[model samples]
Target: MSNRNKKIIIYICCAFIVAIIFYLFPHFYSTTMREAFIYFPEDDQIEFIDASTNIKLIDTKDENEYYLEWKTASETDKKAYLRQDIGFIFENGVLISTQSEWREKTKKLKNKVTLHGEDSGRYEAITFHFAEVHYPDDIIKSKQIMTEDKHYVIDTPLSPLVDFKKAKSQSEQRGKELLDSIIDQQLTYTVEGLIEQFKINKESYHIFPLTEIAQFQTEPLPSMSQEETNAVIGRMWEGLYRYYLLGTNTFTEETYDPIGNTMPFVFLSKDDTHLLVLYETADKKGQQLLQLIPKSEDNENLSKNEQ
Candidate 1:
């Protein structure tokens, strides 16, 4: 071949290589990013009680006795709070019996209030204790005046845990449907009504779209430290602002422009005993998850006071 023909072939080869690299780069980057947050089985000493639900059995080998450890996937290496020794009898990986102690010990008190929106109407303000537990100290401090109660409990039957692995693998539409069904099953009140009310009273309710919350969770703010950023990410998996809506007395400064002028909303059971939150996953892949939380009696006096 002549000199010009040889040069043209070399140029074409270089362009093809460039195109291949560009196509593969995003996949490589995304995989690396996801791996950094994943907690491998070898990283921790505890063995999983149920990999489906990400439930770990800590310290004891007895199948009958369980010290259930619960935490976000990102914080698996860190010490997990909400460790409960629920005396459960397991036979071949199935729960055979629930001890009376488990029933009596599961109750905890939750902060409850009534939100009166000027245009949005009235709503029962149920505090998300999960948010308080996982959020950074500064975020907690800013919202402390909203309530004095500080207790967290997970009623497994009412508030079913999510399988993070399953959620990430599912299609976006299926994920949304799964979330909707979970919420609908547990809720005694109407979520549609709450959403309709929020539409008319947007300013009063302070309701925001899921997109804004996703941005807040996935992107680190300029003011945030590494620790704070990690905590926020952890909170996303635990399903606070991501899946559920928290009630506040005053309107927040940030504004959201929801698609079709409609805002996403959560469902609360009667007397705010249960809450169902629908939110996008932390990966921002348009897939969503439902987080169900149930209020338990903290103490005899608190339960009686509310009654």
Candidate 2:
């Protein structure tokens, strides 16, 4: 081949390679660094059934499972029961994404409430709230609440079910208290703050809040005995109440602005075997759930070495 032709062919190959790399870079990043997985209970134990298939997702012999009553009850009698659809996204052997939809219908109120949460790995989780009410004389009402930058951002003409006005008022009052406390004590609300609050040896331990924790808890695995399930959930709430006591570690951290709001609290045992998280629910109804998350294998080993 002529030298000029050879040079042209080389240039073309280089260009093609660069173009291919550019085209694939986003997919690579998204699958690797940008994605996170929920590997708490191992992948095999959890099943993801597509809603369109109408297949039974949970098959347990225990009648005390929360869903059993809803599953067996008649449609008209299923009031106040909640139905949940949870999904996980896995890439390779890691869980990179997860989402859940919960719906509950109350016969007395003649209303339906839905809550959705999607976590696409660290710092990228969001919750959406929706409610619909059917009133007598053929009147219907609906409302939606969404989050922006980790703070609830509600539109005006708020839903009657979710009184954003009241929440805002309460938030303002609590926010002032939080600011005053932080100013009076010079306390920080980050991981560093947690370490100091517990007098933790930073070199020997790691700490984080529920927002930064893994996508799911490691215990209470699916098909757990009814007693076991209750115990785990019960512990979570208990931990929350214990930590939520006034004049304790409770504090508010601002999100994207100076308007402060209550934040989740973490409890790490003295021996570092147990990690409990207590945080408010997405509904913003002053309700919270306690969760116990097992330390990641890597962190556990690191802590052991430091000890």
Candidate 3:
């Protein structure tokens, strides 16, 4: 194909991909899981899976400042998988946030956030799951979580300062409680939003939800509608990092400490299927997926303890 025809083929391919992506809507699944599959787009092929769903995006707005591909489960063919993610960019590096989750055991999973660059040549990206509480509505809930001396218990005692350590600990506990309460309150009150985004996509454009999606026994994945596709095209992640790499750039290797100071990430699933997760960190360059480790068993799968 000539260069002009080749460009036309690319556009036609993108259009067809968008058409397929919007094919599945309003499907629910019995299990909650997502897997990220890496594909070689430049090669015009996908590996490890047959019959994949693809999406091509273009922002008529913003004059095309952002463009990229997201390789994930295809909601249409049900061959794509979904994973809870938390990602953001930071000045020193990216901070991929996470929370600790328990599975009769304990381990970490990197949420959706990613990061790059550090003040020093050294940094580590840590992701894991943590135990947490959920309220029916985002607008109203009692009790909160406060971490004290690296421990967790709901509803810390509130009082004036007694001793500095005790007072500080107590204050931290109160803060957790207050924050949790606020989180619950926002889901129901003036803070609530999202259901509408689903409606228009469902009735008009025919797109589907990426997370919390349900289909037969196939696979579940994220999706997009005309509006969603529109919303995402121009709006690339507004990361706080000083630099970000395009696909062709080189990256440095680094790791972050996954201990006390990291914040917990929480995902509020609207229909018990779709989740809105918030992570407090980012992933370093070249780290695309955070391995999900159950917190018990053993630290057997951890990256051989770098160091």
lDDT tens readout by residue for model 1, 84-128: 111121211112222111011121322111111111010111111
Better of 2 and 3 by TM-score: 2
RMSD of 3: 22.8
- Candidate 2 local lDDT, 1-307, one digit each (tens): 9999999999999999978987977345333342211111111222222112011112222322211011111112223232332222211112223333434563221111222212111112222222333445543333222221121222122221111112357644454344345432421334344445445565543333433222223333244443333333334433332333211232432122111223443444444355444333223212223254444564345334433
TM-score-wise, the better of 1 and 3 is 1
lDDT of model 3 at residue 207? 30
Per-prediction TM-score to the true structure, in the order listed: 0.20, 0.25, 0.19
Error of 2 at 89 (Å): 23
Instruction: Report RMSD (Å) for each prediction in the order shown.
Output: 25.4, 24.9, 22.8
Runs off by more than 4 Å, candidate 3: 1-168, 187-192, 200-307
What tens-digit string does per-residue lDDT give for candidate 3 at 143-187? 111111111122223432121112246565565555446533543
Q: Kindly give the stretch of ten consecutive residues in candidate 3 with the minimal lDDT sum.
A: 141-150
lDDT of each: 0.27, 0.32, 0.24
* Candidate 3, lDDT over the whole model: 0.24
Which segments of candidate 2 are over 4 A away from where they belong?
Answer: 1-189, 203-206, 217-234, 237-262, 265-273, 276-307
